[model samples]
Target: MEILSNLALGFSIALSPYTLMLAVLGCFIGTIVGALPGLGPSNGVAILIPITFTMGLDATAALVLLTAVYYGAMYGGRISSILLNIPGDEPALMTTLDGYPMAKNGRPGQALVISGFASFWGALFATVMLALVAPALSRVAYQFGPAEYFALYLLAFSTLGGIASNNQAKAAFASCVGLGISVIGLDNFSGLPRMTGGNLHLMDGVDFLVAIVGLFAVSEVFFFIEKHGKGGAVGVKLNKFRVPWGEIWSTRWTQLRCGVVGFIAGVLPGAGASLGSFLTYMMEKNIAGPEGKFGTGVPKGVAAPEAGNNSAAGGALVPMLTLGVPGSGTTAVLLAVLMTLNITPGPTLFTDRPEVVWGLIASLLIANFVLLAMNVPLVRIFVKVLSVPPALLLPGVTMVSFVGIYSLTGGYFDLLLMILFGIMGYVFRKMDIPTVPVILGILLGSNMEDALRRAMVLSDGEWTYLFSSPIAIGLWIFAVAGFIAPVYFRNKIRKPQAVTD
Candidate 1:
């Protein structure tokens, strides 16, 4: 009854002409950005954060547009991966392994069509899951103590290694660096500044947007410049967009299994589309037998990863919306945007911000259909986007990053920080040290500190309370496992592969 009422209200808000138009525009721009290599949803949305602020649009409208761009970009990202054998971002990497082979075999159009549809289905399934699960999850989060919340954040950061690179040490190092950077601002607990450098400007610490932009966008630009200098991109000619329903049906069980797997993975804190896709790919490969050729352009091969990634992207929203803890980088940006809007997300969000929450849910239903219509008929146009000269696009993206960071703080210092982090990001990218964990540390460190202090206060200086609650004990167990599981499993796999080779 409550959800129905919220949906009705959300429909009223989302159906407004202004919001609808903004949604359409955001979706179109996001698709274009996603279709272009090196410009995934994170960069696409970050570049536009300034634009959203400058326009002074309604927070709901701004969010609706931006998130639409996010999902739209995800849908479009499969295009280049399939046609050009190039993933637009790290998450799309799984898409290329089989998608490109299909394209190379003169089925570029078919591959794009299937991948796009798979993305749409995965997103739709996840959206429905969110609508059903978020309210319940929000209710559960209300029971959390600071200790539990802190443990949860620690668990989230630990999961980053699983989501990103298999290197636990590198991931931990990245997370530590982020925590150090996050502590640069005034200490909220001590009431005295720690790393302000005696500068009044540093009193507020670094803006999250500035850090995010520098880390993801500017860093990406520098890296791309080194690889694609003053040249055009490689192109592909898309032929026909056909579904081949029989082939799709043949993989129906695989698609459904992967879709469920993807959704479950998405619901986990810190797990995102990358983990979802990788897991789905591995699972399907193992499940395939003599009847299936595995990765050499089988339809199930494409469908599994596609479904998993799209579903995971949607599932990641569960924690972000219900508990205000992000499962991935892109969702972290969404949390930042929600904060900027002064709309708090947590157990009360569903009741307090029903329009924002349910409107987003309803809009997602519409957006999935919109993506299908757009990706199917416009497959050729998206393919041509690859032909866009890198010389032209790179400068525009870099300029956007510069302007966006500048607008956030209106300070040259922030600009300098952007450049510094941009270089740092470039170096991290080169070294293969996962950047996401750094973001995790920066975002979670303060919260962790807050929880620790609160838990200490409640225990009257006794530290044993940290392990008292069943929930806390459970979380600690999981956090320890998250740290150990990757190293153990990664080495286990590597040894066998090394022996086989």
Candidate 2:
């Protein structure tokens, strides 16, 4: 009954003409951004945040618009993945494995339609799950203390090595790099600069948006240049869009299973949509056995990851809204935006800012419907993004990224910092190092440090206090198990295949 009443209130606000229009506008803009390689949801939201302030919109409306863009970008990412063999964003990487092949096999239209439907179902299901789960979770989160929170952060960090990268050492190193970057601004406890090097800009530490745009967007430019303009053509000619009813029916179970998997993974801090999509694809391939045809135009292959990633996007919001811990890069930006608006997110947010919380939830549902309606009919148009020449596309993307960062900081120094990070990002990518852990580390490092210090202060510097609570102990145990479980399972699975061979 409480949920029902809140939904009523939420719908009333979300359905307002002004809020509805913002949602539509956000969705449209997000699709364009997502269709363009490298300009992901994070860049799209971060760029628009300053514009939102200038528009003088209320907090609820601003959040609604930004979050709609987040959802729309998730929906649109599959377009390039399917048609051009290029992932529009990191999470869409898994889709390219099967989606591109499907297109190459003369079924680009079917692939697009199927992926769109899969995305719709994933987003819709996850929105319902969010509505059901978040309120209760927020209440439970209210019970967490510094020790428990620190342990939870440990769990998030520990799991990343196993899920995000095959090379655990590289992931660990990337995380350390992020943590190191986070410590640059100041020693919050001592009120003294730690790594400022006498620069005022460094006193504030590295901006997350600057790091994101540089790593994902600018690094992409470097990568394109390295490719020397090769691989730019989309050989597959898309036919008129048609509903792939047969394909959808066939992959129904895969979509549902992956949707649930994606949502659960997204709820875990630092797991994000990339991990969710990868895990779902692997699971579907393994389960289908010989019949899966995973690499060569399997509808289920395309559907699973698309569904998983989109659902994970919804799942990522749960921790951000309920606990003030963002599960992904995009959610981290949303958290920053909320803080900028003077709306603190956490358990108290639910009670104190019911309108913002519920209205955003309602807007998510509306955005999913809008994406579904728009994506199917307009897929051909979206796919046309593939025809854009690399010379024009790369420079345009670079311009947008620079403009967005400049608008946000209004500083030439920040641009130089972004260029520096872009070089670092390109180097990291060329070396096969994963970037997500670094981003996650930067996002969570400060909060983790604060929790640890607070816990120590309470215990008079006794480290054992960090594990005194049952929740803390349990989380610590889970962290250890998460680190170990993947290796154990991999070896366990490989032995059987070895025996068969």
Candidate 3:
């Protein structure tokens, strides 16, 4: 009953004209961003976050708009997957397996519409699960001590390397780089700077907003120029543009099951949408046995991954809202937004600002519905986004980053720092180093330091205190397992992927 009333309050705030407008606008823009191949959700969010700061939106407004974009981008990824055989993001990679084939089979409309509905069902399922699970999780988090908190953060960092990584060593190096960047500013425990190099801008540490934009957005621009600046994609024209009610109804159970699987994957510390989608696609294929023809443009093939990834996207919000840990790279960018707003996310977030938490949940519900409506009837519009050439798109995105960052901080040095990070990001990408860990390391470094300090203070500088608590010990076990287990599981993830799909 309390949850019900809280939801009512959320609806009241989300129903406001201003917040609703932001949701609609965000969905529209997010779909376009996701339709662009290679930009992905993390880059999409990072690119637009500076715009929110430029707009000077309050916490509620910023969250609603950005989260709306998040969902919209997830939905829109299918556009490229079906039409261009390109995934808008890592999470959408599985969608290409069956999505492109269905398009080639001359049922692009059915594939697009089916994937849209699958996305809707998956996201809706995860949102409901999130509402039931997050509050309980947040309450449990209140009992964590410094040792437990440190262990949890360690678990987050340890698992990041396994996400779509070819080399764990490269990921570790990126994490070290991120932690190194995090320590550049003045140390709070002592009133002295650590690695500021006598620059006033370095006094506050590297601004995460600058880091995110440079790493995710600007770096992509650099990679595009190096790889495919002159290239363009040819989209499969949509024929028989109508809803596939029969197909959608037949795949209802698949959508429901994939949602469950994806939500679980999203809730894990480092297992993200890519994992969710991969697991669900494999699960569905196995259950259907050899007769299912998974790689051959089946409606079930399209539905399974679309639902799983979108569900994972919603589920990824769970840890971020309750534990101040990001379940995915995109959520890490969202975490940066909350940090910049001076709103700390964790157990107290629910009690300290119930309005923001519930408002975001409510607005997300509306955004899911808004996405379904836009995606179905407006499929034609999003398909057109594929025609946007790299030449114009890359420059436009780069300009947004520069203008938005400057408008928010008004610092020339920050711009230089952003370019430097961009260069670093390009190098990292070329070397096959995962960038997500680098972002997470920087994001969680300060918190991890504070937690470790508190633990040391409480235990009189005894290092054993870190493993004294059962919760802390459990986290340490998981962190170790997460880091090493991925190497064993790498073949399992790769073997199931169908080459043609």
Residue 108's C-alpha lDDT in candidate 3? 95
lDDT digits (tens) for residues 191-212 of candidate 1: 7887888988778776777777
TM-score of each model, paired residue for residue: 0.94, 0.91, 0.97
Best by TM-score: 3
Clash totals, every prediction: 0, 0, 0
Better of 1 and 2 by TM-score: 1
Candidates ranked, most accurate by lDDT first:
3, 2, 1
- Candidate 2: residue 439 Cα off by (Å): 2.8
- Residue pairs in clash, model 3: none
- Per-residue C-alpha lDDT of model 3 across residues 1-501, encoded as one tens digit per residue: 879988998999999999999999999988888888867788889988988987889999999999999999989988998998888777788888899999998999999999999999999999889888999999999989999999999888787775546677887887788888888888868879989889888899998989998988898899888886644456688886667899999998999999999999889876778778888999999988889999999999999998998898899999999999999888999999999999999999999999999999999999999999999988888888888788888899899999988988897988998998899888887777878888888898888888999999999999999999788899999998888888997876673221101
lDDT of each: 0.79, 0.82, 0.87
| Error at 314, model 1, angstroms | 0.2
**How far in Å is the alpha carbon of 90 misplaced in model 2?**
2.8
Of models 1 and 2, which has the larger lDDT? Answer: 2
Q: What is the TM-score of candidate 2? A: 0.91
lDDT of 2 by residue, 92-146 (tens): 8889889999998888989989999999999999999999999999999888999
| Model 1 collision count | 0
After superposition, the stretches of candidate 2 with alpha carbons farther than 4 Å from their true spots are 49-57, 487-501
